[model samples]
Every structure is written in structure tokens, then in C-alpha cells.
Target: MTESTIITDNFLLSNKKAVLLYHEYAKHLPVIDFHNHLSPLQIAEDKKFDNLTDIWLKGDHYKWRAMRALGVDERFITGQASDEEKFKAWAEVVPATLRNPLFHWTHMELKNPFGINSYLNKDSADRIYLQANERLAQDEFSARSLLKNFKVEMLSTTDDPCDDLTHHQQLIKEGYEIKVKPSFRPDKVFMIGEPVTFKAYLKVLGQKAGVEITTIASLLEALKNRVDFFALQQCSISDHGLSTLPTHFTLSLAQEQEFKTFLKSDQAVFSDPDAFAGFILTELCKMYHERNWVQQFHVGAIRNNNPRMLHKLGPDTGFDSIGDYKHAENLTAFLSHLNLTDQLAQTVVYNLNPADNEVIATMLGNFADGRIKGKMQFGSGWWFLDQKDGIEKQLNALSNMGVVSTFIGMLTDSRSFLSYSRHEYFRRIMCNLFGSEMEAGLLPDDEKWVGEMIQNICYYNAKNYFGLNRG
Candidate 1:
């Protein structure tokens, strides 16, 4: 029998225009991954995986979730099972993930790196495993080479405020080919939902900045210092993962007593403190604007739902899901608070919930004041919504409500090195959309015009938007 088609040359491109757009324009553009969870340390260290499972199975919550759903034992996923066992377990789940994005991503990763074209299943598990592991033993499959294989031009890694960014500094000193920059992700500091942990985080930030975090003012100041430090390290982007935007707008709690009262309030629960989050984000955005930096908000993920598994495996082990939280009012208020002062930085807003796609797309246009082309971006499909359908919806929503042409595009937002295939996956879907428009007479059949637009969305837009060409 013929093998399943997952990573074909014309995969997902239905029409002539799409196939041409993808092959001519989108295919060869280098990726600019502006936001991701990739470890700078691994890149700096030039870490080499011992086997395919070491790179593919480990820390990949996407695969872990699928394996668990297939009733594969936990030992084979995020447990004490050997690497070979985990690979076999994932192979078992791959066949069951037919309609899921993982099936395609799995195949794309296999084909791109290992050149393994066979379907991953119970029948082919052992052979594919040995073949991939044997290939991993080679020099080109190292972490850095894997990035180079994807032609990743530059990538911004999500980093905590308390992080020293020593690894980023090391990469700069090593003079690696791809630019790996750190993006300030101070979500935990404002995550006053866990006051005790938040307070501990505050102490760490204070120590990092050589300041005392007694109130919100000091906290913001300490954060500003860290932002300055990150800037010194050539960092130019800030990222936040939030459930919803905050409603309150107390600029800086002027009175000490009021600040103390608010700080000590029982309002800090499992839910994010909207008032505090909005206020802090408003202030942080100003700092970003001051530095001519970009800010990204990954909103509406309800994380760590399974208490039992959360206690055992910890967060980001695939226990998160899309949240239906109302984010418009607070997100609008937060951006407005910054825009009125003319301190709103170039922003990218990403929502996990597909329901909020248009909400965010429309909301972004409210803040773009013609200064920059795509000053405020309705970001690409994110988190649970990065698949084909999700990509189509986000592209359509942005195209309908805002300027999709100038939109900064795909990022892995993942921990694994092999995940850069996601950019290719997104580009194929994007070209198909634009190509179909041309074929249907919706867009003129000017391949040159539409082709450049495809390149802009795939690479150039992000390159210009992030000032990647500036230095």
C-alpha cells in the first residue's frame, strides 16, 4: 500500500496559485521566530541529543498529551521509561492522532530531519526508531544545526524577569549564526494569584535589580531595572501569558495605605488579579515603548487544571486548555491606557480561544495610530489554535478586520528544537489562502504582487516589524 501523505511537496496547497505562491515565495524564506520557549542554554551549549526520543519525546507536552489520551502508560511519557520505550509509545499514539495536527507535525519533523518517509505506527515503530536514532548520532542533527536546517534567521526566547540571561550573553560571545535574543516575560511577577510564590518571585527580582519590592511602585521599578538590563543584552521584545486583561486603572496607587490594603487583599486567588495585571502591564508597556521594543500578549489559556497530575508532573505538561474568559474590556482598557499617553509599544496580541480571534483582531486596530504599518498585530493562531483550521480562521479574521498583509507571522512557542517545522506548516496554509483568493478572482492574478505579500507575511513583515534588519 502507498504511505500516508503528510509532508508532500504540495501539501495543503489546493490550487495552482497556492502551489505557486508556496513554492515560489513562501518556501525558501528564512523563519523569524519572534516568540518561543526554546532554551538559550541548549543552543549556547550546542547540546547534542543521544537519540530521537531525547529531542522529540522529552519535554514535548504535545506528544505527551496524545500518548495519555491513547491510554499509553505514564511511564512511557514523562516517567521512568527508557528512551526507546517512549518512542514506541509515541509511535502507537501517532496512528490514533489521524485528524490531529500532531499527525502532520510528526510527519513533517520526521521527513525534514531524519528523512524518514514511512508512516509511524506499531508496525513501523522499531525500524523507524532505530533509523532516527542512528541519524541522531550524526553531527548535523545537533540542536544548533537543527535550527540552521529550518533556516531560522532570528528567534526571541521567552524569559523571566529574574533570569540573568547569561546564556544569551554566551551565545552573543560565541557568535552563533542565528540571532537568539531574550524576550522579557514577567508574567510570574504580576501573577499575584499565588501571593506567596509571587512574593518569593518579587524577592528574586529585587535581588536581581538590587532593589526592595515593598509595594507596586518598587515592584515596577525593579522590573524596569530588569528591562534595562535585558535591553543592554540587546533584548527588544517583551512577552506575557495572561488569562484576561484587568479592569482597574489605578495608575500608581499614590497613597501608601491604599497600596498596602490592595497588596494584602484576599482578591489574589486562582484567577489572575486583573486590576494589578492591567496596571503593571500598562506601566511595563511604557518601558517597552521607551526602548522601541515590541510587546506580545499570549492571552486566554486556563492552565494546570488537573490538580492530581499537576502535583506530580508540574505545569506545561499539557494540562492547559483554551479559556472562555472575557478579555476585550480589560485588554482595550490596558492598551488605551498606554495609547492615550503615546507609550503603547508595537504590540502582538495572541488569544488561545478561537472565539476571541475577531475580538482581538478588531481590538488591535483601535490602537494602531498610523505611526507604524502594523503597530498593533492580531497575532497568528496560537497554543491550541495553531493548526490548519485555526490558521485559516486567524488569517481570515485578520484579513477581514485588519491589515493581514503587514502581520508578523508564525513562531514555534515550543520547547523542542524540531518544532520549527511549524513555520513551514503555517506558510503552506497561508499561501493556500492567498492563492485561493487569486484563483477565485477575489485577488488579482498578479503573482508578483501577491507573491511579495506572501513573503512579507512569511518573513519580511516580521523582519521589518521587529527591526531585525536594523542591526
Candidate 2:
């Protein structure tokens, strides 16, 4: 009947007694997004999208997986369906997504963007969808507008060594107001002998760096050149996505040569994946040390084996599943190996399995050594846990076991522009968590004190920790 109240002055700060405090604390804080999957090219080009669907729906595996789990057909999720049809299908699935985080996030997006609150389903689908599409057609909904609306002051985008970073350069030249920096992601280089994609990467890296990648030494040199190129473009973070921690190992010169020889011979190292992974991770860590960069380990994900779905839809199309990882002991050993030699970079550890949250959170403090205020961090509630419940739990775990002031706030970790709503979601959850705590007397009742905590969690902490905005 009427427009939904999108984001009220106190929407997230709804616990009336604490509402004033939240508003006072969170309103003017700057955003420091240290890790995400945002595309630097879009920010550089200051591109405008054709419509809302392309910005919100395309390239979001989190939404794609939810749609798949709701039994929406692949055509709507990943195939050639028209935007209207896809939105309609998504509308039908929205109500059924109750008790899921998607339920809340979808409504939030709809309410914030189109000012609609009626449930998205068969009855209201057409009217609501058309209005949202009309808003998308307006000039105010461009990519730059979206970022500014979300108050995204600083954003980091995941990048690969083979990238030329023309987009990053363009963004700097154009003098856009927001900060968009690249973070190196080197998973492709380590997928060697895995029977999937390393060979292709070899050819590409060779072409980009002008080197023969037949030997591990040459490959390292090529990767080094690319890293230098990225650093010149202002990239100061590196991300590693691995299934486990690297084990202790000393590679003899002969062994190193043998592994390089095996690669040239096209022999499979899948049988001994751990040893190779260990060596590669060790080498990558040494590179981080040399560059004085922050390193991120997004570990414990098992991915891309579903032949039918992967072939038809492709990687990150919802074929990834969580694994039971023995991370605590192995991770300790791995870090100890680096620590013993003083070779560890400023590191943040992100875990996927919820069961390991406590272990991961506590394990980080074990490596703190007071060298850096928050040297080893339990990264934000990732993938499956990027919601209200997820964010709260992560905040509690970190607050109770470690220092929350050292915590980095929300990251898109998304490939879509509209996914910035995730940051809003996180900020809301942070406000609610702190607000409720204050109400409960678990924390101080003073407005200034509690407000500082909220501001730290939402923005200030990440800014200080990441050394952002020095420019």
C-alpha cells in the first residue's frame, strides 16, 4: 500500500534506549574495507550500469547459491534469462528464504534502493520489480553513485599477477574521490600439477612477464616482476586461498629442481599435494616479507568438483562446499615455522567452517606476540556467515577472546557493485550488538564510550590497522 521505510535514522539502532548513542557514534565514521572481491576496473572507469539487475544480480555467487538452493532453475540464476524474468523468479524465492540471511539482505536491498517493503512474491512481484527497474534506469544509480551512497571511503579489490592494472591507473588519473586499491591473489600460480588450470596460467604469465616459466626459478622471477608492477600501482595486500596450512619442509636444491622438472614433464603432484602446497606457500610468504605487505589466508575451502554444475554453470557458481579442517594444530605449526625464522608478514586468517570459529579466533591471539597490535586476526565472518547472526557471533568471539578494536570491518568479498549493502548489514549488526550490550550493562552505559566502540568496529579500527588513507 505504501512505500517501505527504507533505512530510518535508527533502523539498526532500534533499541530505543541506545538509539541516540548509535547515531552519535556511527554517523560520520569513514569506511576502511581492507579485503573484498570488488572490481577495480569499474571504479577506475567510473562506469554506470544499464540497470539494477546487472549491478545486484550478476556476479554474486552468494545470491546465486541461495537461488539455486531455493530450486530456481539455472537459467534464471546463471543462464540467458531476461532481467525481468530473473527478478520475478527471485521475488518468488524471497519469501521462502525466511530464517536465512538472504531473507533479511534481500529485503534491505529492496527497501533501501526502491523504497518497497511488501514481500517479494507472486502477488507483488510485477509492480515492485518494475519500479525498481525504473529506478535503475535513472541517472543517480550509477556505480559511482552507489559507492558514494554506501559511504565506501576505501575499498580493496582482489587482483592477480597477470593483470595489467590499466583500470587502477585510470581511476587515479580520473581523480575519483573514493580509494580503490588492488590486493594480490596468487592461487593460480600454485595450482600447478593439480590437473586443472596451472598450465594455462603458465602461458599467460610468461607472456605478461616476458620470461620462460619452465623452471620454478623463472616462474618466481616472473611473479616477482608482476608483484613489482602491482606495488607500483599501490597494492599492499596479498591473498592466498588454500585448503590447508603449509607444513614444515626444507626443499633441497635437487628437490626444487625435481619439482620444476616434474612440471615440465607434465607429471601430476596431486598425490602429494601437501608438500608442493607447503613449498609454494613458503615461497609466497617470503615474497610478502620482501614486499612488506599484509598477507591474507582464506583457507579451508573445498571447491569445484561437481562436474554437472561446474561444466554447465562454471566455478563460483555454487559448487563450493565447506570441509572439516584440522586448522588449529596445523595452523599453529605453520605459523610457528614462520615465527621461528621471523619471516611471517602481517597476516589475517579467514576460516570458512563455523565449527572452527572458536579455535580460529583463539588461535589468532596465540600468534599475536604483541609485534603488531592485531598481527593475526580472525577475519570477518566469511561466505556462509556474512549475516546478522554470523557477524554478531564473530564480533563476540573476537571481543571475548581477543581485542575487537583491532578488528577490520566488512569487506564485499563480492564481485557485484550492489553488494556494498553487505557493509551496511555489518554496520547494523555491529550497532545492534554494541547497543544491546550497553543496554544489558555488559558494557559501559556512557554514550561516548559505547559510541567509540561502535565507530571502531565499523570503520576506525580497519583504517588504523590497514594504514589506509596515508595518501
Candidate 3:
């Protein structure tokens, strides 16, 4: 495709009404990236990339997975290849990613910050590389500057409980324009199976929280301490990444003693990992409720499938896939356990498996106790489900089973700075969905009414839901 034709102003807007909704309503809205994997240190330092690959390719498993699929060597994907070579390797695979979201995302990223609209391929790779590098050399392409260019009003970076959050503190001290808050993610606290790792993690977490974690009560105290510390940093969100919600929600007295024994002994193995995790998770949710924090659960990912590659490249190196874990029963038990106690915080549940779309969507209604609009949210399509088909299916399921208007929308869930284009991509797709229905007269012909709802889904809903407007 030519430069002009590749990504036009109306790209993805299927009809005139779609075009109007996108251009007039959704196009210029500032992004509230409530959840992402962006590096806080990079933002705090306002780091500038030496080249496109330095910023774009490094730590991007999505591109690495695509590169691996095309038989690109590991050296180019994640190994010690030169940045230029990696960029070329990625460019060579871009054309092959035709129907993939990467095709659109790669071009959209190139079009936006770099302003390179030409399609990336082997022939054009060198030219695009030089052009993009020229821009990267400029001060405008720095990490913080790029966020400004994307009009990101606020973003929450996923952080570990043991982290000191010095970068987040630095950003605050400097009075950065964008709101960069940390979300407490204590997934490691649930890694009871890896006894040595779990014990070591507890040591660090205890030191960080100024508590000695020996029993279940101590563990909860330490976690609560970190939650309080994160709250001091303006953190109102906590996240958990699990294969599925634990089937067991409470610990029996015997099991609780077993956990205590296991924590003390080096060789004592905890018998029921699920019950132990559930006990801690249940307590954490209650703490989140006490602090009025939003809790996010990202479930149904079977990670590190390729053990050989995992051993070679470490985790988050494109070795995870969607899992088919039974979510409904455990999810219901977990949520109900909290709801019964009135401890259910504002929750967003994300399922990686597409099969669970309706499962999650409908589950949102089970406990949305009329106090909050979209209190229980079926989170936007994530991980393996962040593309077009997955996004549409998620939207369709939420619309069919729950209220779509109050839905807080898309997040990058990405490690790359360039991934902000995903918000624009989502806006166009969302506007098209609403605009097409407007044309068909499915609801109403009033653009003002419909456009306001479109704007809510795109921006306002999340702003209100997350209480970002208050600050």
C-alpha cells in the first residue's frame, strides 16, 4: 500500500457515520491508560531511544513471537543482534503479518510518532529505519514526550509489592504532567509451589513492609502494609495474574497450620496450593475494599509452555497462550465470598480465553450491588485476545449480557512506548461499532446522544470509574 492509502484518516471507520463518530467524538480524547506494563523508570528519566528498535523492539514479546513464527533467528528476536538487524528482521515480517493486529499496529505506530506511512517490508526496511531513527534522535521522541504526544492523561504501571517505587516517586517529585501511578501486583506471594523462591520473596517483601512474615497473619500484615504504602503513592489499583480463580476460598484450620509449618521449614511442602492462594487472595481483596482500590484479575493464561525457550529466554518472552480453565464456578465462589462480606472492591476481570467472554460478562451482573455504575467490569480483550476479532467478540458479549455504555475501555497492556496507538485503534473500532448501529437505526439516530455514549466508552467512563476526575 502507498503512503497515502495505507492508513488514511478514515482507516477502520467502515461508514460515514463511523467516520463522523471517530473524527468528531473519539479521535481527540486524551488517553487514560489505567492498566499497562510500561516502565516507570523510563518515564521518570524521560529516556530517549538511539533507534526505533531500541524503543519499539526491545522487550516486545508480540513482535518477538511474530518474528519467531516467520523463522527469524533468536539473535534478531531477543538475542544479541544489532538493533538495526532486529528492526530489519521485524520489518521483513510485517507484510507477512497482513491480517494480524501487528500489521495495523506497526503501521499505525509508524504513522503517528514517526510519521512514516509507507508499508514496512524487506525493500522499505532500510528507508523506514533511517526515517524513524531520525525522529528518535529528536527530543520530541523521548519517553515522556511521546506520552504527551499520545495525549496520555494518566497511566498505571503494574508493579511488584517488593518494589521501592522510587521511579514513581521521582515522577511525583518532578511534578510530571501525566499521572503515573503504580498498581500493586503481588502475584509472587501466591507462588507457594516454588518454596525457595517464595521464601526469598517473603524476605524482601518483609523488609520492604518492615514486618517479619512467618505465618498467614504476618503475610497478610506485610501485604496490607505494602497496599497502604502504594496508597500513599496515589495507587488505587491492585492486580493479580492467575491461571484461574482458586476453587478454594477459605483455609481450614488444619490447612492454615500446614501453611504456618511450611513457611518455617525449608523442606515442608504445602499440600493445597489453591486453598493457600485463595486464603491470601481473599484477604487481599478485603484490604483492597478497605482502601477503596480497584482490583484487576487477569486469568486464563497458561504461561511458559515452551520450556526450552523459557529456559533459554526467561519468562514473558513469548511463551504463553490462552488456557481453558473452568472460570465460572471458581469465579462465582470467589466474588460471592467477597460480596457476602461486603468486601468486593471495584473489580475488572479479564479472561484470556475467548470461550469465557460470556462467562465473565454475565458474572459481572451477579454482584454489581447498584451502588456503582459498571462496578463489576468484563475487562477489554487482553493478551492473546487484544486483536480485532477478540475485541469484537468481547464487545458483543458485554453488550449482549451486560451494559456496554458503562464499560471502561482499552488498555495497552504493553511494554513498548509505541503501543499507545492501540488506544486510537480501539477508539476507531468502537466508534465503528456504535456508528454502524446508528445508521441501521438499531437504537436511535441522535448523534448527540449516541456520540456522548461513544465518548463515555472511549474516555469519560474510565475517568469516572477510576475517580481520575477527582484529582
Candidate 4:
């Protein structure tokens, strides 16, 4: 039998054309998934999967985007199609997905899981698909089982404050070995001027905290109560998905209080969306620092502009595009406000547009205070850049300008369970990068050290950064 076609060579260490590195170093590193969208409920239940396509292609806008790029129609992208048909469509698109990381990842998933050597295409789709579906039918391919299979040590799920986290609580009660924590995302809570939606969220928060949020102070108090609740449940991070860092302008407590008054008033226009948005982001960041939690800012995504899609599908449905903003100066202004303050917490900034990668990567170094190591970070190339070119470019920029050793690795940022294939995709890309570097004689010929470095970027940095320990 032929061995599966691995994307990178295992023995190509340090360009010396010698020395096979032990793959053991790759095996032991713990995964610190600092950002992701994995379902906490499925994790809590350890639910098994029925087939590969259901997990891989369904609801994955990332894959959908690529499939669309390949001329696959919306009927297959988001329409009602059988799982098998979708798989076949995806398989048909697989070979053409070349020069795209999905092609490599599809093969990686096949080799790593099913140990199948055949490439996914029209000719091989049926046999390969059936074999994987057979494996999925077994109990081992469940959600939690998949996490364990990929050696995910820590997973941070993005959640809104309206979430009750009953599932998170259940996972803790069962003492699940993996660390599945919540990252507080309060975007909806801060949209106060929009009466219909804001009032609804206020009610949700108010009901959950059992507080009457009639004033700005009361609203903050309600949010604080929820933050405390999340803390008790092992959440130590707050995530902000904003258009940019909050503007440096600060409202006086009295002025902010008055804004709350405006929220309750019927005269406030829903236009000029940032009135409450800017105020709430500033206050939330302050709260983040007060709690000494690591705050993550995933900024620069221009989302949901397609009216037709927005009307039908809702957010995160592939309509979001990269924004071309002045990220550096704005970031400098935002950090300048908090850099000297004692309330400043460790922060990570991820840019959606890769052209800004070098700019943001360098900007992070400017804010590092020697007071704490890794006080600031340019987060991994996210969203569209999660692919091979994306990860490689991020690694190069970070390694050249900042320390790659301090870098934390990949996050799924996905809603689908099969997206864990991303970890495999990331690992192979990392291994190939390191292996190719070793072959070029630019780095040392020490396989063990190189392997460890690869593992750290793939896993260890995130594990230690989040303090998620399984031992």
C-alpha cells in the first residue's frame, strides 16, 4: 500500500539533507485555542458525528467562500442539499482548490484520520467519502473525542452575555478533562440606542442578573454581575469584535450617565451607531482591566453590508469583508490611553486585512512595557488569512519583527465541528515551514530543537498563555 501524500516532508530538517526528527515532540505539546467558535454544548455532550461532510462543509462560510470562488453555486454553498451531495460537490472542487490551503487541509484530514492515500476528486470521492463516513458512524468521532484526537488542551468559545452557559456549567460538573472556557463578548449589550434590539438585550441581561437596568450605572453593574458569573465559570478573558479600538475620547461619568438617559428617551435616533458603541467599548475595556483579564480585540472586519444576505441569512454568513482603515495610528492612540494606566490588561490585536500585518505586528512591540512579558500581541492572521499563505506570512512578520517564540497559534473562529481540521492544517503548514527552513541551512540542523519550536508555535505558546493545564 502507498503511504498517504503528506503536504510536507517529515525528515527535511535544516536543509542539511540529513537527520530525521522524532515526531514525538509534535505529539506532546498542549493546544491553547485562545479564540474559536466551537459549540460548548456539543463539547459538553461529547456528541458523535455521523459523516465527514456534515461536519466539514455544513455551515462553514470559509469553505463556502472558497467553493463559491471555484464557481460552485449557492444551492451547494448555502442551499438545502443532502450532506452526501455537498460532500461530492466539495470533493469535485477539492482538486481545483489548489493554491488554496483547503486542498492541503482536505488531504491532511484524510491522511491523519482515515489514513487514506487517495486524493479527493470526482474519481476518488465516493470511496474516500464512504470510508470517512464509516469512521464517523463510530463513537470515537464525537465532538469531545475529536478535540481529544487533535490534542486540544484549551478552547475559548465566543459567547454573548445573553447566554446562560448552562452547557458550560454542565461541562465543569462532569469534570471534563479539557479546558473549555468562555470568552465574554458583549457587543450586543452595548448597542443601547437601538430601542428594539438594545432594549431586548438589556432585558436579557437584566433578567439574567436580576437587576433593573434603568441607568448607566445600573447597566454597568448588571454587566459586572454577569462578568463575575463568567469568572466563576473559569472565564478569564473578554473579547471585543469592534470596527476599531475604542476612540481615545472618554466621556465624563456624568456625561455617560446622561447617555443612558438618552437610551431611555424616545427621541434618540437609531442613526450614528457609534454614540453608544464607543461609550460601551471604553467602559468594557476599563472593566476588563479592572478584572486583570486578558482582553482580545479582533478589529477591522467590515461585516454584513449585503442587504439581501443580511435580510435572509444573518451575520457571519460570508458577507463580511476586510476594512482598509488606518489601523496603526488608531491603535497607537487607543493603547496610549491605557498604556500608562495600572488598569491596563494584556491585550491581543488581530487584523483582518493582511496588508496591515506588518503594521500591526510592529505596533504591538511599541506597547510592550517590560512590566509584563507578552503584554501585547499581534494575533495570528485571522479569518481569510487562516490558510497556508496567511499563516506563513503572519509567522514571518512576527518572527522577523517580534518573537515567534511568544506567538500563540491557530483558532477555529468557526461555527462547525469539523473545523478542527484547521488545527491539522495549521500543524502541517507549520511543520512544512520549519522543515523547509531546516533544509535551506538558514536554521540549525538540530531536529529536536526545531521540532520543539514547531510544537510551541502550534500548541505550547497558547497552552501556557491561557494557563490551561491538563496535568
lDDT of 4 by residue, 1-471 (tens): 223464444522233322233245554455677788878887887777768877777677767878877898777777888888888888888877777777777776777556776788887888988898898888877888778777777788998876889899998898888888999999887565566777778878999988988876788889888888988888888888877765544556666666566667775554444545665666677788887688999988898888997788887877888998778777887777676575567888888888888998898898777876577878877887888788889889998989887777777778766566676566656666776777778778777788777777777677666655434
TM for candidate 3 is: 0.98
RMSD of each: 2.2, 2.2, 1.1, 3.1
Q: Which whole-number lDDT from 0 to 100 does residue 297 have in model 1?
A: 84
Give one clash count per candidate, in the order shown. Answer: 1, 0, 0, 5
Better model by TM-score: candidate 2 vs candidate 4: 2
User: Lowest summed lDDT over 10 consecutive residues: which window, candidate 3?
Assistant: 1-10
* Global local distance difference test of model 2: 0.77
Q: Specify the poorest-scoring 10-residue window by lDDT in model 4.
A: 11-20
In the range 72-165, model 3's lDDT, one tens digit per residue, is 9999989888999989989888889989888999889999988887889888999989999988889999999999999999999999999899
Q: How many clashes in candidate 3?
A: 0
Candidate 4 deviant stretches above 4 angstroms: 1-24, 192-195, 252-258, 268-275, 434-441, 444-452, 469-471
The model with the greater lDDT, 1 or 3, is 3
lDDT of 4: 0.75
Stretches > 4 Å off in candidate 1: 1-4, 251-255, 258-272
What range of 10 consecutive residues in model 2 has the weakest lDDT sum?
A: 1-10
